[model samples]
Target chain A: MGVPFTPRANIIMTICLGTIACVVTSGCLLWFAWPYSDYERHVGWTVEQPVPFSHQHHVAGLGLDCRFCHSSVERSAQASLPPTFTCMTCHSQIWTNAAVLAAVRDSLLRNTPMTWQRVTNVPDYVYFNHSIHVVKGVGCESCHGNIAAMPLTYKAKTLTMQFCVNCHRDPGPNLRPAENIFDTDWHRGPDTPGPAALMALYHLGRRNLTECSICHR
Target chain B: MRCAWPLHVLPGALLLLAAGCDDMSKQHKENPYASPRSAPADVAQGSVEYHDTFHPAPGLTPALLQRGRSEYQAFCAPCHARTGQGDGMVVQRGFPAPLPLATAPTRSATPEQLYAIITSGQGVMYGFAQRIMPDDRWAIVAYLYALRRSQQATLADMTPAQRAIQP
Candidate 1:
């Protein structure tokens, strides 16, 4: 048979193959990196809630403790949101006539809970317990970031497996004194214990924090 | 013909692979506080109903006082200041000032009465029955008494050892 193709066909085929290879390689890289990206992880994203609750006003301005609203953080796996009545504890007296508190009043009157959108969350399979972390001297700001500074709450950290595993592997640097556990603005000071001392103080040295079952189960 | 058959099978294989890509992050299980329904009222421990008669206060110990101090700060410090002065941040922000713990009426009030006040709303103050445990209520009562004593403490009231140690 006579040559069915020109010599230019080889050059065309090489270009076509090179383009396909480049596309496939980039596609694979993007597929793997997509979930790890902050955009996909919802980090720093502000979620809309039924009410525009301001952590800045309540926490920094009014000086309300973290436990005031999230009452079960130290006792339960979940850091429970306050019931409507908890809001009424102050709103009933202070902001009684404000139009902004209409939903809170409605929730109390209707006896239906005002559904709050969770700003930070993990997958259902990951059993993250607030009580253990709080008790172990992990300050609220360590994971939640500067909550007192957030006028409107947003997801402060990417709560990915890598984020969890990084802390699980070495929890010492994150640990704070018991007094500073709830302090959102707490930072290590001159007298603050070092990593090894804190690890020993919290008795975390003996525990296998990175064990799969610790979180997965 | 053989290449055409392979292409047909390839499409089916790709479809099967795509079917497995469904997200497993969220499952059909309930997360804590995920439901919009209001939680059922908390029933008092060792009682059938939410309301219960007087229960004796827990024995006072250093640990109990420590627990009481932390609990008091968390729950009561907003309206009742950390010093029990009834001039807390919330009060400054416009909530009516609660009676200072050292006030005669509050001072003379029985532990059971203080516990009741904490468990059930007394005037504008919301009842913390749903929030604070019964044991914690008693601990707070104990702390309140301690707070009252501290507010009224004089040099004469201090022990000889405490007086000596005072700077």
Candidate 2:
């Protein structure tokens, strides 16, 4: 080399390169750790279903109630899937000849149930009751996101433990009147009671709201 | 000089990882939940083949009537009140009031005539033909009759059990 590099200069250059590497690596690690960066919560991710059911069409266009198909949401643990008969209620007359509805027809004729792919799931250790949440002033959109706008249903929320804990910690911002429980697009207005008041109004201020047994058991 | 291996491999590895994470099965666009375009009506009223020939479908069992009532509550109750009074929430929200089904002239109409009215839009009311099945339509007719009967029932019409529970 022309004029061999001094040992001090070489040491300084190595330190500078090492510092850049440390900063770049830490920055990347921070970005990846963000909860929203998880691919599952992002758009363009959809589960393949036997029948492509568009929530946007039924809920938005037709204005069908969430309870029309998910009947048990008001009183049961599971948001029950619509039975084959429910599909036949409309399909039996309309689109009877459409090729796309062949699966619906086959299931009816064969007396077999159509198994819709479950989009959102929770760990077995966690107990989530739909009826309790629905009756207690939680809106359908609170946890499910903008379901009426989804052309194809996808898991909107990450449903991470932190997500659940955040809501359980303070539910006022998410609470609505009993009448508006089904209104997904509900927004708190200037005159509306704040979350703290709603929590008190709904009797949801119980200290054990975050206890393990409240959900686990 | 820095080795060129990492420069070539790093981006390629990241791209491969991204590609690997993508699911290929969700590409189909056929969505049955979307309301398909209704077929164009070929023939109009007054044609020889277009005579008012719709009849009340038979097999009006108790179960069917029950199912009809439930279905009516789900589908019809939004515009037509559960009591058939035409004072549903939609009307309260400024929609023009529909004729009450419990009215004398409406209650007197035959089920077939009612079915025709339901299948075809009359005045401001749109047709429910694409939404309700023929069987369920008849079931709705049965339920309508039940609603009319309940509204017009006299004390004499009450059974002993009903009389006992009347209070």
lDDT of 2 by residue, B9-124 (tens): 99999999898885433434432232222211222222434344555497979988986786687667766788899976656545577789899567789988887776665665
Model 1 chain A weakest 10-residue run by lDDT: A109-118
Which runs in model 2 stand beyond 4 Å of their true positions?
A: A1-36, A40-44, B1-167
True lDDT of residue B65, candidate 2? 90
> What is the TM-score of candidate 2?
0.56
What TM-score does each of the candidates earn? Answer: 0.87, 0.56
Per-residue lDDT tens digits for candidate 1, residues B58-158, read 88998788878988998999989999989999999888998887886888888888888888768888788778877888888888888888887898998
Model 2: share of real contacts kept: 0.01
Model 2, residue A138: displacement in angstroms? 0.8
Q: Which candidate is the best by TM-score?
A: 1
Per-candidate DockQ values are 0.47, 0.04
Angstrom error of the Cα, residue B69, model 1: value is 1.4
